[model samples]
Target: MSGVDLPGAIRLVRANNVRALDPAPAMFEGMLRGWEQQQRSRLLARKTINDRLSLVRRFAEFTGTYPWDWTPEDVEAYFATRLSRGEVVWSTVRGQQGDLEMFCAFIADRRYGWAKACLEEFGRAPVQVCHDWNTAQHVAEFEGRPGRRAFTYEELQTFFDAADDRVEQIRKKGRKGVLAAWRDSVLVKQFYAYGTRRRETSMLDLSDLRHNPRAPHYGRLGALQIRYGKASRGSPPKRRTVLTVPEVDWIVPVIQEWVEEVRCGFSPGRHPALWVSERCGRLGVRRLDEVFAAIREHADLPAELDLHCLRHTYITHLVEFGYPERFVQEQVGHAYASTTALYTWVSDEYRNRLIEDALQRRLERGGGGTLMPQ
Candidate 1:
């Protein structure tokens, strides 16, 4: 609002005949700078802002046209080409469409002054090219790859056993990584025990473990304060406190052992991170993945089973543990019950047990003596 409008500023430059070999590049640079400034002012994360900008740049490259010349047909053709390549999935296409629409909408907004700038300089302005008719629809709640499922109960046990065995094997061989092996072992245990995402786990500090008034039996480990939770659109990181559920309360001792014994062995006077590297820095998500992947390989799990499968395992196991759906949803910081439901994969044994319980309930109510025909 304080400076001359961007297009007007560009017009003044062109009128001056500064004699640049190519004025278009300069004009485009100015527009991008303005757009990025606007996005940053909205408090979007740097990664998200970059992603949106990249989408716009790719669209321009694909169409070989400026934003002012873009049309809905251009959007359709871009998506058509991406789909034909067989690399983009439905959800990815939908996300790309949404990002493109947001960029176009920003430029097209009258209050933003971009539309006016483009209209005056180029005789046209960018329009919302990605429309409902051309965009991918949100048809299903769960569109994750089919191979990515919760680890079965037996598999979960084997995975943890393998992690523990790594520590023992290192100690037996007089290897150098006994402490590091122990740390990775405990880290994987806490990952599933708490149902935390990689970033959330990476960002956690010792101070994040707090006491729950209702469950004081667990003392300082009664709850986990998640500081780097997944954020909502246009919002900062969301924070939530995941209580130590009765079932996963076993992690209380695991965290206690790490805090009391193993962690103290790390370089003293370091950062107050619960999980620290040998160099006295907080463990990052990439290292966390390597830890899980190594254990998964040793356990002979499928290649598709990644660290995120531990989260899926947590959600599915919670359902089998008979925690209320709403409680499970809240524990995992899901915004919606449907999103939580999407993570659940009930086991055949759990399903059969449920059927048996229903049959017993009917017998107690005197509603049946023999099995009913389907």
Candidate 2:
């Protein structure tokens, strides 16, 4: 048997009891591989492919059935049990459903022959289980937690001051990690300077620092060439250049100081990461969140104010600085103007000022002194 031709032996065995062989597992594996190949052909990111695969496996495990046996009821019951446990959020459930939908769509597509394979092996095939009835709806432009909002101007000032003070306090005590402290302090400033997501910040390289012709005063730090902007479904990461406008140009000096002085103190053989760790590697996304959390605590800011709040603050301030909506959208690398608007959390004072300016313009136009409710 050990020396027998494997394909011949398999054929002889299948001729006897194909059902006894229980080919469901092997058929499922083939379908998964086909789905992965399809995703790869479509140029989906590796992480995204892995995430979808993991979700499919989890759903199968939950239902005690293979993809061939999955039904809409299984999907609904899985989510129901999850929600009852209070372990997952609506957003997370929505993402899981999206992943499952893509997987099921792949297995059900006749072009892939997964349906034929499943039907021959187990007498059934996978079908789409995710639908609007079992999934969350995108009702509002803002689906984020209610507590997550942009930092106010005063709060932003306090947060920055706290970061700066930490560095100063370390230096005054002749601490060994003053360079690290200085790096964290400047990194937080850079986060606000550019409305960058955490992973986007982590992927920055020295060469990404570019100069904008219109912002000569900012020198080589006038813009950031973001090479790893968020990718759409089945697409590579989107790339964009975020310019340092005059309003946040003050960050130019801070970044210059970090690159010229403090970053140099790190291991010289390290990668060209904008933020490097003491271990001579690029700072990771988790470390970035930890740094922000520490600074936020020291600043006595709201516990709910995560690093994303910095991005919100940037968008809010840019609108207050009178930048055009289109320009803001481009700088933030948002595909739609409405997406950029979602990040903006302008202050009440800014809204009042806008109202005042509107009234002034009306008076200048001699509108018979009509006042309108805002």
Candidate 3:
């Protein structure tokens, strides 16, 4: 790497005579600010920067020592405490350690001059404390909760029935929130119909619905232009368009009814949001979770199944529906096919059908020979 200028306009460097009543704490805060600036210049998102900073602060508090005195032992102790409490999974531990590693790299870099400043004042300098030996290994692609899974076919139908039934139940009482109840019903339908993540579903605008030339019967509801797809680290939200599949095409009329009739009842004058809350123009991601939770409870579904399982349900159904895996990957906006595979948990019935089909094909090839054991 080319030599970087000393101090480099970061907030860490100061005059020799500059001092604070509490110099250690002051310098620690300055180092954090300088690290924040470095990450900002890389165009990382605000939440990403804040999360990394928060992790470093927690580590420091746990160790009761400034960055300059941190050691590999402190890293082990801190994470061991978290492990004892089951505070994080393996993937989360790895990410937190990576954050500490990056922070150490920032302060220790000669270009920033933080080490020089710390050495002159405290006679100590920060060194990278998180090493391969002490950090969590990234051996598994999926480390999510084992109980979490896609909804079963019966469970899927029951949940939808519950959401739909709630609307009429509200109307029967002649309640004021009937319009809102209707909105939630339509929202639930779109969730399974499209398989969007919560934030992506919440961020949808009326303009995101588009006309498909080949699927003209469905009109503007034929495709969904997902503008806020999930992104990888240090990147902006991704974008993809999900075409409506024939199996879930029944949602076409449900969405159309919401837009053309029930949505106008919300009296949202000029808001472009497709899912308009009764109190707000656009529904929020948190509200999406709350709505799903209420419906799942009402239906008495398994506690382990969550809003994201609607997405899992979509992926599994598509795989069973025999769409090409590439097509399924594109519809769900997964960058890799392996990621799409991780979301799928096909039902035993689907697996049995595959076995039956294979046996039938073999029997036909062998002219009905029944004694073949290869």
lDDT of 3 by residue, 1-374 (tens): 22354333343344446778989998898898888878887878898999999999999999999999999999999999998999997778888999899899988887787887789779999999989999888888887878889988899999999998998999999888888888998898899999999999999999999989999999999999999999776688999999999999999999999999999998888999999988657999999999999999999998998999999999999999999999999999998999999999999999999989988998878856466788
Q: Is candidate 1 or 3 superior in lDDT?
A: 3
Predicted structure 1: lDDT: 0.85
TM-score, each model?
Answer: 0.89, 0.88, 0.94
Model 1 residue pairs with clashes: none
Output the better candidate (2/3) by lDDT: 3
Tens-place lDDT per residue, model 1, 39-124, is 67677789988987888888889999888888999999999999899878788889989988877776777765666767766788
User: Which parts of model 3 have CA positions greater than 4 angstroms off?
Assistant: 1-17, 367-374
Q: Write the per-residue lDDT of candidate 2 for residues 45-91, one digit (tens) a residue.
A: 89888888877788888998898788899988998899899878777
Model 1 vs truth, CA RMSD: 3.3
Identify the leading candidate in terms of lDDT: 3
Would you list the rank order by TM-score, best first? 3, 1, 2
Worst 10 residues of 1 by lDDT: 7-16
On lDDT, who's better, 1 or 2?
Answer: 1
Give the Å error, residue 75, model 3: 1.3
